[model samples]
Target: MSLHLRKPSFVLISGLLLSLAFTAISLISYYVANQSLNQHITTNTLPLTSDTIYSEVQRDLLQPVLVSSLMAQDTFVHDWIEEGEQNPEQMQRYLKAIQQRYDAFTAFFVSEYTHKYYHSTGILKQVSDTLPADRWYFHSRKAPEEFNINLDLDTANTSITTLFVNHKVTDEQGKLLGIIGVGLASTTIKELIETYQSRYGRQVYFIDAQGKVTMQGSQFSGASDIHEVKGLQNIAPEILSSPEGSYTYTNDNQTYLIKTRFIPELSWYLIVQHTEQSEARITTTLWINLTISLAVIIIVLLLQHFTLGGYQRRLEYMANTDPLTGASSRHAFEMLFQQILNFAKRQKHPVSTILVDIDHFKTFNDNYGHLLGDTILTNVAKVLTQNLRQADTLCRWGGDEFFIVLPNCHQSNALLIAEKMRQEIEESLQVINDQQLHVTASFGVAEYSNDETTVSLFNRTDLALYRAKSKNRNQVEVATESAFKTV
Candidate 1:
């Protein structure tokens, strides 16, 4: 009776409604599956990844801290500090030994008696209570912790970024002597993070309790503050307060899963974040069945990916290379310097550095305007490139100061090279607006010492450069070991 009463239009309308219901069910099922997969990843996979990171940090970063503590308790360090720290050469040699034995970036010591900061390079600076730069030493003196990890400029490697493991040095009576520790380059930490991120496809970063990013993987750049990261500000407060946990955050209509773990050793938070946007994309694709439209979307995505990849490569190149001189940038040169130093240490070969400063550069800039100054810089760089060996590295350190590194070269050879470079620069001419510009530069050369660090070598070389400038401009001076010993 019911079938007879139903009209054709009613039956058609009922069939449409049933189809719609099935479609809705399928969509809902897809959504559920996606959510389940993401939850599984956050709960199971992220914890494992976080554990791996923790283990690596323990092995690499914490080991240094432990070693530093052991050094603090060692009789040799205590005896050395107690002996008045009179022989800086001995102190320098001991610091160098510590650095070499542990394969640390650098080693340092501070003497409460002399109020002088000592490192592999000899006396770095005099610590004063009033100076802001010396405050770290004073603060460490009062801190209760046995050791602490912090970021500071690595003066040895041209003030490049470094992570310092500062440990308090004390005497047998438990009185504070000074401080001693090692440095790890920030580049190394970044590389470690980048490797893990690439292997596991997770965003990994280390942030301090104050929400400042101390270390991070290569995926993030430019900014290090946690609040600055996209989609992180909303959940940052909770993540900081909790020692270990997971949370979800949504930004720009996309969801992200975050896992946090506190590292007591570093007093920093280890954060791992995973985005669900990929899963969302998959869900969207499931609902769209237009073959041509799908193909078009894929093509556009491919184009965008390639374009972004190329752009990233270009940016990296620009960052590493000097824009005006086409020489290595300071940061890039520091990385290369470290590699060369390592190689030299292993091979027992000598490495030499030369610092070149353009003479009367300020006067020239004042007379000729910045455009001509830039032209002169470019011309000088060309002359330097022509004179240097292909294996050598030339860097525009800063403001009319150029640095060159020569591997497997001694002081005598480096001095000769510097002399030639000086002469070439003096003769090199830049013509602008029908006028010839003449430039002269001063050169300072220093060879790497077996027990000296890059910073010490740089300081010695800089002193030689100063001597050259003081005696007369456009001259080459080789740093004498006596100069370093005196410092």
Candidate 2:
């Protein structure tokens, strides 16, 4: 059942009466509201913004690392390296495909044994133990980690600096074969970081495991290393060790609140810095509040309707949304589904539901870990959402499963749509937590029948889904409209 809220007229009337009472304790209410706003900024706004920036960074920047991982795992690269790397043109073509497909700045491979560097354009150069410029190749080969991100100037491909993700290639026996990876233009990344600052009104930058500031906007004056930054220097060691947390520090006599998240894929720390001093500079707002305190009746009477309605809308949204995937909540879905069913019955239009389940999701979750699983789930939801029509409704039915309602669509058309969605997912690779993954989904389609309850219809759909899974997964199965079974 949906909530029925009283009209904002009631709130306005109540607020007008309260405004008169507020004229008596206006000073006290001003202080309380000021404190509440400050707390809200720090507690809710900053952390929420931090999480958003973290996700965007993962989506935008971590892709190259994932691409490099795929390149490392490709059999063609393995076979070519194993065969003595004689075909330079073939390797160049392969590298070119990787670069163009991903839109990376450059793609390259370095052979440790032959000390030869192959770029998308062909052979770039040969590395040597003595050359300082080629130290990155030797360091990548000697490092215990499977991959390394080196930010350096690219003299071979572009004259500008680039961030290269170098991943180690190995044979079936796990013996080191070579190194392969892609480069991203530093300028492009810097521009992206700058946009984050303007968009979120926070200073966003990245620091390596050792505290060196590896990435930041061009307009930002963040120090080269966290240790050199005024306030962070004191807590640099603790910040480096902690996986994720919010820390407060004083920098240049200004108090700053910073949230740190350890991005394991890139081995970098995402630092989102917010200045509390700006909010604390509430002198102007405090004056306005005190001034409004004198005329509290006018202010509350003026804005009460907008404030109450906005808050009610926000609360309703929070209640109706799935926190993890941003899809409709089951409660919200039920309400919407019933509305659609009623309308379809009246208009005599077809309505169909598709049940989508990620095949072998539990195994993927177990092997790759929950973080990767959540990332995959989020991406899958985005894909489904993008493909949905304006009238169609998609809901997070449960973990790793999505329920889609296509109004005015017959079972056959819905089945075709499901097949399209399946093909899109099947053809794409999802990279998460520094690992590349191929994801495919199974779908079950069902059309609404006369006087059928939601429970009975979905039960049949679930049965069809079970059949699809039983038939080796990643295929679509259909349920007859005439079938009626309680779940």
Candidate 3:
């Protein structure tokens, strides 16, 4: 009886297997390619691009700063200011020569003794502390840095936005004479940023340390503050904290690769942002290919009826388990958690989760190599599995992280279980490179609340985990009941 259907079943099963294989191949190929592209951008392309932009900015903007510094140090300018700035014609001629020689947009000097402003056009205005327009000179006097960049109105150019490199002028006695600086129209900096953005196809902008957008390419002209920019405000804290580096920022469900370099000459941060939309396009293309492959496979399978009991079981196991640690994958964990959540909702039983993170996992990888990291991860998974109930679900939640779902458990019980697991992991040792390596982990436990979505519950647990890591690692933290009550 079985032999009669064997041939037909074999043909159908083969077709189904081939379909799954092709779909998996397409997905894996897309994943690898996307990862390679992102890695290339993060490691090679972004740094090179940022360095190139930094060099270009220095080449263009450094001249004004140098000119301002030179003018500040000039003996003639110092003597003129010391002479009470009485010779207006001489001052005007001197300013004109400096501005024309350097091809600067404008040149200016403020006398500390006379409290007067002298420009290329001569005695443009008085240095009044009470006037907002004249406040730049007062502020420049109090500034600690010898050379500073500021955005101010260019009176010579009808008060258009200008980049001023203000340099402090002091006499031989080290007394402050006044401020000497050269101005360049802000449009010049904007054009430079626009040119770079167009050439590199990256969003370019200049941000001061306070996160104020001083000058930006036309693409980002809508917002003058980094905190107001969409997809950027979310990661503004990280950006302002880091002096120079690369970071990945996620907003509106899209991720952006942000590279930042500091421009000391301008006292501003140069930011180059590129989106991962290319990866999304690649995934979309692969899905289209997979859909075609699936259609072909379905047609072939329908023509031949299929069955592969053992092979199907193997495939199911592979799909559900993490290849490296033999623990449940994120997908499998989500499915199981959903089932547990449904049952708990009906039975009025509680479901809890513990998010675990290995402490200093990156250090382990750096010191012992990635091979040892993999070994340690596998061993840690084993330790977690041995400590959990058979009904509990243990999942590999990406690198150096694991999630354990406990059904029919309350917050207190979940915390106890997490603490036990944390201790077990701390005690567990791995012999790598002939050295005994003891590992520790941080745990965050949270019980699901009534009417709470899975995402909200997970976020609460993640917050607890973050707190645990922040306070101290190798410990367990429980989410506050009030925190989930609102969720």
lDDT of 1: 0.77
Worst 10 residues of 2 by lDDT: 292-301
Each candidate's TM vs. the true structure? 0.50, 0.50, 0.49
Best candidate (score: lDDT): 3
What is every candidate's alpha-carbon RMSD to the true fold? 21.5, 14.1, 26.6
Model 1 has how many clashing residue pairs?
A: 0
Candidate 3: tens digits of C-alpha lDDT, residues 1-487 = 4644675678767776776666665555665778775765677556756876786677667779878987998866875666666568978998999889879899998888777778999787777888887778888899888878878787666659998888899877878988898998888878878876875667898889899987786678446787886767877888888879888877668778889987766778998887776777756755664575466456545533323444455557868998779989998788888889989999999899999999899999888655578888988888889888888999999899999999898889888888888887787654555777778899999998778888889989998999999987889988887777765
lDDT of every predicted structure (CA atoms): 0.77, 0.79, 0.80
Clashing pairs in 1: none
Ten contiguous residues with the weakest lDDT in model 1? 289-298
Off by over 4 Å in 3: 1-32, 221-223, 229-231, 279-487
Candidate 2: regions farther than 4 A off: 1-35, 155-158, 277-487
Q: Taking the tens digit of each residue's C-alpha lDDT, what string does model 1 give over 1-487?
A: 3423443345446445544543554445464777665665577556756876776676678657866886787665776666666568877987898899878888888777777888898788888999876777787888898777777776566568877888988765788887888888778878878977876566888889999988876567525786776667777788889999988877668787888999886788888888775766746644552232234334434544455456556667878999779999999888888889889998999999999999888887788655567778888898889988889999999889999999989889998889988887777564545666667899999988777777887899999999999987889988999977865
How many collisions between residues are there in candidate 3? 2
Arrange candidates by lDDT, descending.
Answer: 3, 2, 1
lDDT of 2 at 102: 81
lDDT of candidate model 3 versus the reference:
0.80
lDDT at residue 301 of model 1 (Cα atoms): 42
TM-score of 2: 0.50
